[model samples]
Target: MYRGRRRVSPAVALLLASLGVLSGCTNAPPPPVVESTSSTPTSEPPTEPPKPKVVVAGIDELRGGFNPHVLADQSPVTDALSEIMLPSVFVPGEDGERVLNSTLMESAEVLEDTDEFTVRYRIRTGASWSDGPPIAAEDFVYLWEQLRRQPGVINPVGYRLISDVESRQGGKTVRVTFEKPYPGWKSLFDHLLPAHLLKDAPGGWSDTLDYGYPASGGPFAIRAFDLDRGEVVLMRNERYWGPPAESDRIVLRAADRSENLNALRSGNVQLGMFTADASTMEALRGLGEDIQLTTMPRPVTSTLLLRPNSPQLSDVRVRRAVLAALDRQALVEAGTGGGPAANLPAHAQVLAPSQPGYVPTEPSGEFADGPDPERVARLLTEAGYEHSGGKWIRDGAPLNLVIAAQFRETSYEAVANSVADQLNAQDISTTVVTPKGDELYRTMLATDPGVQDPPRSAGIDLAVAARPVSADSAATMAAQWGCPAVDPDTGRTSEFNMAGFCDQLLQPTIEAAVTGEVPFRRASERVEPTLWSGAVALPLYQEAQVLAVSREVSGVRDGAGFAGPFSSVGEWVGAPGESYDW
Candidate 1:
């Protein structure tokens, strides 16, 4: 320390001493200094700011089900990816009501509620997919055509009510005529895929969006997705029509509970949204005040779906008998245990019990509380089944049922075992088959085996699967029960009916209720009794989605319904600090 001043280098000091001696010797004749002028300043150059880090978000699993609309292709990573990359007609506003996204639409309004309810949608001229195609009616038609009958879709109710979709303005504008007024129409076409890319490619639904969305219309687009490395990266879409996203990039990393927690503590991941146990939740709590943890109800319910298309279970009486034979309370207990799902016992068929305005649409006394053995027996007898040698039989073949459950889901496996045991006790020969999720949802549950002349014996008649139920009450009702209308012109039948059963009689009422023709409550009142009597679904519980975000990232909040934390991805940015390694 040189007298509270920065010490000068020895070389500079020597140079200074030499200059002083030379100036002293030539005191009279000091040469006029010639100035060499340059435009550049003599000061040191300014240092550039450090580049921002890629926002790493930890997710439970990268199951790679990136198609948010399809139930089978639903996971946290998928939901997050879809929310940021997919286009929507109406985004959830501050009040959670459907508001038009100015970027995607020029105008969307009801043309008239005439004989056939008509609505018009005009796409913004500049709106185009990340790939190449312009965002147009073709995309809308593709989704409606695929969702209406292709099966495994989330919200197809409003699409089912559409009698026709006519494209105008060189395919930029769409005129839709619904069979009735659809109040939840805004919920349709939230995640529109590129029609030119996926409409005709084989495995149109499941295989296309397996890794990531082929095209993005929103502010971000998928850059790279690697399941082996457990990461899906999204970069800013340079071609996005609206205001650019504030963040440079978003990376979703697949991780287990412990690893996810570790990443959060180590700051390897700034935000995390994953499924967590009590211990994991506690671990998150221990991460101190900086971590923001939230628990939201996932739009999924564990359900025992009885498909009526099986020749053995074709009769409505037989389907109801199957419901009567099983003890639902035991099934729920076996599946949920003491998990988060245990708390939200699903009571209604359309709207999950956790949803707002959820009244137990479970009819008064069709064994609303428990199994009814007498009801099972009477229904079997009425359906022409004869009880002989402790087994129900028709045409000398025993009443054997094949139940399919996805092997990947532990809770569902337990639920399936419970269902099998309950049915077996009632003298029903039941065989529980554990199929891969793809086979279970895409093929077994999706295909109507009974469509063949002699019903296919190899396929499953019942499925224990996760049914995603959204807060859109009308959409849920129609998606679950709205009969896939037979188009007399095209002659295409419903392919992926979640429940193989179809009720033509109740379909119109369902249509009326789903479309704004009948109020949701009144429609549910008129629909639930007959719907429950059909005994199609045995909903166990609503699954809860968990999110843990650190203070390092900002602008996280719940969206309208199933949008999750990723809804605000456009506004999310990494906190300024040291550069990140990842």
Candidate 2:
């Protein structure tokens, strides 16, 4: 069975705000500093307050699972770890609208194209890995070459986006070319491994067991990892190339929500990360006035993937019937208590709101204010299905559905169970399958095509996956879907379309969004209709991560969750502050 990592509580967030302690960190301007009119007339300028010393801890710790070259479950652990290392590229921005961070390379640009493509990067002079080794262009060259030769290496997303790479002989830069115009190529820069560190990675780069332990070049390095004790401690990297981190040491201690909350109250851990279960949130009020909390929605969407290829699901009529049957509003309310800001099911595609080409689509069925069983029954009837012996049937078979649920997603499981009940009420038989974590990725996501449909290797029928895109660049369509390759000569397609869906209308629009040479606005107009109007995938609730710190911490600003758990790691500071009781 899969275990769940801790999640920050929203009720607690609301409660904290009610108490007027440091609450949610929003981008809103700080409540205007009230002016002391007469007293401030004296000629002295106001002095700034000292930075606060912030200590942050969470239930999840860095597991040294930071290598992006290999396939692994993405989580706050990996997200936090990525900031310290340099990708050949990085997505820099909020709400999945990230851009390339030029940590090691000064600039990168496309240099050549063919069925095979090539782009070049100019490395920043004097850039060195945390180990003090000079970074060379051949590092990426070697990295890509290894990826190409490895068979079990299933990072098709990167492979689909990148065609090939070449290390410039007698040069200070590296060039990579793609089979097609992969709009999301910029993500490669987010983290690039230092080739010198893992040149002999065992079983080749495809062997995750060997490749997993490769070197890191971030601001911190793994000091210790004790899984049985459930603690991973990280220490400052003295060889860091960027501005130094304020804390000399960072301890990642794993604990449950109750333990995390207790640790916070006792000051055993300066920060606590826990899911905002009802009890945890309610108890935060008693955690004292010195605690600070902030939360932001994650770049993820929970969804139900309908296998259109299934004998019972392929009909547009059936797809429409299923949509009509689900009470998404009720599902969100039951799962989150406070429904999403909008009643609309969360969009399934990974495009962020800030993405230049993002378009909002309407739900496909009778998306009303609430669930209506009569309306659901009516849709089923219109689809040529009839109620017989108190069950909906088509082609002499009962309408039965088996939904695969990933383990440890308690909220999602609740939602799935509720959905099954609703469908059964509508005379449809539905079953929920809860699978273990590894099996979920391999069977559900990799093979089933339901969790990650048309499957990343094949095409996905439907899936509810999280995808973050770069907001800085004009190209914002998620690489997972829009980056599908087209044969240069035959003009045929590659099986990378996550939806396994290709509409004449959507195909042209997706192509324009990815390969169009026009401005962002034009591309958005073309792409928006498909996303917002077609409602190919439903958008559900946005997720969030919360940070709680001691009053001593300062310079902590509001940021997206994925950038890092301590996203403001580069800016956090600590100084003397009033005692906890005071």
TM-score of each: 0.82, 0.72
**Ten contiguous residues minimizing lDDT sum, candidate 2:** 573-582
Q: Across residues 1-582, which tens digit of lDDT does each residue of candidate 1 receive?
A: 012435789999999999999889874877799896888876556556666546788887776566777766666666778788888888877765678888789899887656777889999999999887799999999888877665566776677778899999999999998876767777777877888888888877768888788888888887887889888778789888988887778888887878888999999899988665556667888999999877777778778887776767778899999998888877877776655566788878777766668777676665646678898899999999999999999988999999877776767788888888988889888998997766666666666433665335336778887777754676677767766655434677655467765677877777677656777788788777776777777777887766788888877777666667788888888764444344
Residue 371 CA displacement from its true place in model 1, Å: 7.2
Q: What value of lDDT does candidate 1 attain over all alpha carbons?
A: 0.77
Query: Per-model C-alpha lDDT, please?
Result: 0.77, 0.55
The residue ranges of model 1 lying beyond 4 angstroms of the native Cα positions read 1-49, 112-116, 163-167, 179-181, 200-206, 314-330, 363-399, 421-428, 447-458, 470-472, 576-582
Across 92-173, the per-residue lDDT of candidate 2 in tens digits comes to 4665455455665677786654455567777666666767776776677666655433322233344444555666644457
